[model samples]
Target: MPVIEVDGLVKRYRDVTAVDDVSLHVEQGQIYALLGLNGAGKTTLIRMLLGMITPTAGSVSVLGAAVTAGARSAWARTGYLVEAPVAYPELTVRENLELVRRLRRLPGGTDEVIERLALAPYAERRARTLSLGNLQRLALAKALIHAPDLLILDEPVNGLDPAGVVEIRTLLAGLAHQHGTTVLLSSHLLAEVARLATRIGILHHGRLLAEQHADQLDQHRRRHLHLGTRDDTAAERVLQAHGYHPHPAPGGGLQLTDEHALARPDQVATVLVQAGVPPTRLLTEEEDLEAYFLRIVGADHG
Candidate 1:
C-alpha cells in the first residue's frame, strides 16, 4: 500500500488557488520531494496531506487511512515539521522533548533523539537561547523522537550550516535505507533535493508541472557538446560548411546541439582534425537542475 496518496487535490482562497489538481502517491520507503520556489503551494499541499487544512476538491489518504479533520488515521505513526519551527521559548531543550514524550504517551527516547540530532550539548539550555541552527535541530529532534514510520518535513534544511545540512542528509538517508521509513519533504532547493530524494515532483504556481525519478532526471535535462579551438572564426566556418550547427557558448567556447555531435563526439573530433582545426577542448555539458527547472517553468507560461 502507498504511504501517501493524493487525488485531484485542490485548495483555493477566493480564486487564488494555493494547490491545483495535483495527484501523487508515495510507496513504502520512498523519499518523495516536492520541489518548487517560494509561494509555489508546497506548504499548502503538505498541510492538506497532514490534515491540517482541508482541500476544496479530491481526497488524501495517509498510511491507508483517509485523512479528515479531527480524524487522523495514523497520527501516532507520523512525524512532521511545517513552515517555521516553534517551541516554548522558556522551556529547556530537554524539557521540551520531555513534554513531547509525555504528550505522545511514548515510553522513552528523548535522550536518544537529542544525541542523534547533536543537541546534547545544549540539552539543558532554554530554547530561546539556542542559535537558529540549533533551534532547527531541536525541531528535527522532536519529529524524530518517536522514530515514526512516516516523516514529513518542509524545508528541512532551513537555518542550518553546511556541516549541519550534511548531517541531516546522512541521517534521513540512513533512516530510509537502513530502517523502513517513508519520507515526503518539500523544498525549493532543486539541486540539493536532486541528490537526496528518490523521486521528485516540480510545482509552480499551485500546479504540478513535472514528476520524475531521481535516476531518470537526466532524461529531462538538455545536453550539448562543447568545442573550443585556437581559431574561433575558422572553427565556426568549418562547422557550418560541414552541415553542423554551432552556437557560441557563454564562456568563450562553441556549443553544438546536433544529435550527431552528442552521440558521436569522436566523429566530431575527427572532422575538426581533418580540417586542421583540431579542437583544443571537447566536452559534453549537461544543463543543471536549476536551469532545467527555470526552462520548464518558463516554457509552461511562454
Candidate 2:
C-alpha cells in the first residue's frame, strides 16, 4: 500500500478554495516533495493530511488509515517539522529532545539524532541563544528523536547555511536509504527539492499542476538545443511561426522546449541557420528540476 494517499481532497475557507481536488500517492520508502509558492495551499493540504485541520470535502489517508479517525495513532509512527518549528526559548537543545521523548514515550536515545544533526556542539545552549541556522538544526533533531517511520517536513532547509543544507540532505537520504522511512517534504527551493526528492509534485493556485518521477521530469524538460543568433528577435520569430514559444535566454539565444514542440530539431536548426543564426554555436542545456518548475510555475523572483 502507498504510505500516503489523497483522493480529490478539498479545503475551502469562506469564499476561497484553499485546496481544490488535489490527489497524489506516495509509495513506501520514497522521498516525495510537495512544491508551491506561498498561499498555493500546499500547507493546507499537508495540514489536512496530518489531521491538524478539517477539510471541506473529499478524503485523505496515511498509512492505510482514514485521516480523521485514525490520525492520532497513525501519526505515532510519523515525525514532522513544519515550517520553522517553535521551541521553548528557555529549553536547551538537548532539553528539547528530552521533552519530545517524554511527550511521545518513544524508545531509543536522542544522541544519534543530535550527532546526526550536529547539534552536539550546542546541546547545552539555550534554544534562544542559538542562531537561526542552529535553531533549525535543533528542530530537526527534535523531529527525528523518535525515529518515526514517516517524516513530513515543510521547508526543512529554511534558514540553513550551506553546510547545514548539505548535512540535512545527507540525513534525509539516510532516512530513506538506511532506516526505510517514507518522507513527504514541502519546499520553495527547487534546487534543494530536486536533490532530495525521488518524485516531485508541483502545485499552483491551490491545485496540483504536475507530478512525475524526478528523472523522467528532467528528461521531459530537457532542452533540444540552445540557438544563438545575431538577430535574436528573428530567431524568436522563426520559433513562434512554428508554434514554439522558446523561453528567453541571454546572449541572443532561445531556450528550446522538449519533443512536444511541433517542429523537429533538424527543422529548427535549419530555420535558425537560414535566418542568419549561428547554428554552429548551438548547444544542449542540461535539464534540471528547476527548469521543469520554472516552466510549470512561470518565472517569479520571489
Which candidate number maximizes TM-score?
Answer: 1
**Candidate 2 regions with alpha-carbon error over 4 angstroms:** 69-71, 222-224, 227-280, 286-288, 298-302
lDDT on C-alpha atoms for all candidate structures: 0.92, 0.82
Can you give the lDDT of residue 160 in candidate 1?
A: 97
Window of ten residues with lowest summed lDDT in model 2:
257-266
lDDT of 2 by residue, 142-221 (tens): 77887788988888888888988998999899889888899999987778887888999999888899888776765566
Candidate 1 local lDDT, 1-302, one digit each (tens): 99999999999999799999999999999999999889999999999989999899999999999999898659899999999988899999999999999999999658889889999899999999999889889999989888899999999999999999999999999999999899999998888898889999999999999999998988888999998999878889988998899989988979999998899999888888999999999999998988888887774344
- List CA RMSD, all candidates: 2.0, 4.3
Give the runs in model 1 whose Cα sits over 4 Å from its true position: 299-302
Model 1, residue 202: displacement in angstroms?
A: 0.5
Error of 1 at 116 (Å): 0.8
